[model samples]
Target: MDPLFEFLLRQGDNTLVLGHRISEWCGKAPVLEEDIALANTALDLIGQTQMWLGYAAEVEGAGRTADDLAFLRDAWDFRNLLLLERPNGDFGHTMMRQFLFDAYQIQNLKALEASSDPRIAEIAVKSGKEATYHLDRSRDTVIALGDGTSESNARMQSALDALWPYAGEMFLADEIDQAMAADHIAPLPLEYRAPWEAAVLPALAAAALKVPQDDFAHQGGKTGRRHSEHLGHMLATMQVLQRSYPGATW
Candidate 1:
């Protein structure tokens, strides 16, 4: 497989899996408004994933469809960073996860907009707008929950603490990333980290949430070295229908 295609699939697969997880919240959010908002966000993410994965398939000259890439692949083949696959424990936890991931995503898409590959750049350009909105809403929710009632504050704080370590994995580059950087198809991972932190810290402070001070940063989850226990359950829910009725689709 071409390195570019591999890179795109990794990106697309991450978004597809995470979007599937978030979509599970569609009718389950605590409030009607939140339910609609999450559903819309999920749709946007899945749409972006489709475009990227489709392009990736073309780039690879593979006969596989985006559905095949998304649903047929086993867990070990997935390359999503650990932060996204964690269970959504509570509304606070979900919003914190969104805030963290969306912050990094916005930075990434903005950089990808200038990619050497025009297809990748175009996808990034289109998705960046949706990502911007996601980041805004998530940031607002983080602020609200972080500064809300004592219970809300405590829960949001705990969410951040639990998720902080996984944040580091977003910036860990491997061979594919090195190829992308060398080809100017993407920016260096480290280049995004400082800006990502700068963008996130003020929001955390505004939320009255203390960023965790843990020195241990989580890594190696991209290659599936560390698996989230929640992932198997998530995959079962996501793939059960396809698994049960092969080639069945509406």
Candidate 2:
């Protein structure tokens, strides 16, 4: 696979999988405000996914549209971070996941604002606006919940502990990353580590959330070699409509 295409898939898959997960909370969030907010967040992520995957298709020149790539690909082909695929157990858990991913994304999109590829830079610019809002919203929620009460704080802490290890995957680089970096298309994922930590750690400290002591990073989500069971189940529901009715347009 072309490194650029793989890089695009990683970008799109992260949003697509996580977007579907957030959308699962529609009508199920604790309050009306939260319900609407979750839906809108999902929409933002999905919209970003369209741009990333759309560009990936053009780069491939393989006659696949964004929808085809999104709806037709199997789980093993996905290259999202494993953290996003983890279950959103409670409201606090959801926010922790969002904050972690958004911390990485905020700096990432900012970095991409200087990408050598003009298209990637433009997409990053547009997506960065939404990502800023996402980080702000999610970070506020994390702090509020983590400092709220015994129960809420406990849940937030638990979520942070469980998800922190997965956070390391964002920084571990491979050939695809090297290629992107070498071409000045994008920086190596490793380049974001300091900023991601700078962005994530303080928010977590403010939340009274304890960062997990164990830092065993689960690898292979981006490389698509070791995705968790969660992604397969997600794809089933997300792609079911298109899978069931191939070329069935409304």
Candidate 3:
């Protein structure tokens, strides 16, 4: 596969899946303010996905558009990390999941902002700003819930443990990452590990939450080799209108 096209799908697919998961909370957030906030956050991710995937279509030159790449892809074709496809459990689980992904995203985007490719650089700069806000929001929620009460803390702790196993995959580099790094397209994923840990650990500390010491890192989605069953269910719902109507638009 074209490395740049594969890389773009990696970025866009993760954002698309996570954004759709978060959007599930639009009308069900614990409070109206948070409902509005989650909706806005989801919008940011969806917008970024569009830009990245739209660029991917251009690079492929196969007559596919962003909508095609998103709604038309099968579960096995999505290149999103496994963490993003996990079912959103409680609010605590959702926020912790968001925090971990956003932390990596902020660092990833910062590195990409220096890309030799002008298009990638521009998208990185635009997306990084939104990612920063997402990190802040998710971090705050983690701290609040982690320190709130026995029940809240237990739930938060459980979330951390469940999500920790998937954290390592973000830094797992393969041929796609190596090619991008060598071409000045983006930095190696492993290079962002230190900073991602720096951002994530302290927040966990402040929240009195402990990181699980799991060495088993579940991976494979980067190459579209594996995905959680949740993603299949999600895509079924997400692509419903598009699939049924076949390009119906407002």
- What is candidate 2's lDDT per residue for 29-75, written digit by digit as tens? 99999899999999999999999999999999999999999999999
Tens-place lDDT per residue, model 3, 191-213, is 98999999999999999898887
Deviation in Å, model 3, residue 158 alpha carbon: 0.5
Q: List, in order, the clash count of every candidate structure.
A: 0, 0, 0
Q: Lowest summed-lDDT stretch of 10 residues in model 1?
A: 219-228
- Clashing residue pairs found in predicted model 3: none
Candidate 1 at residue 193, lDDT?
A: 94
Candidates in descending lDDT order = 3, 2, 1
Instruction: Look at candidate 2 and give me any clashing residue pairs.
Output: none
The lDDT leader among the candidates is: 3
Q: lDDT per residue, candidate 1, 42-143, as tens digits? A: 999999999988997788776988888887877776777788888888989999999999999999999999999999999999999999999999999999
TM-scores vs. true structure, each candidate:
0.97, 0.98, 0.98
Please state the error at residue 196 of candidate 2 in Å: 1.5
Candidate 1 Cα misplacement greater than 4 A, ranges: none
**If both were scored by TM-score, which would come out higher, candidate 1 or candidate 3?**
3
Off by over 4 Å in 2: none
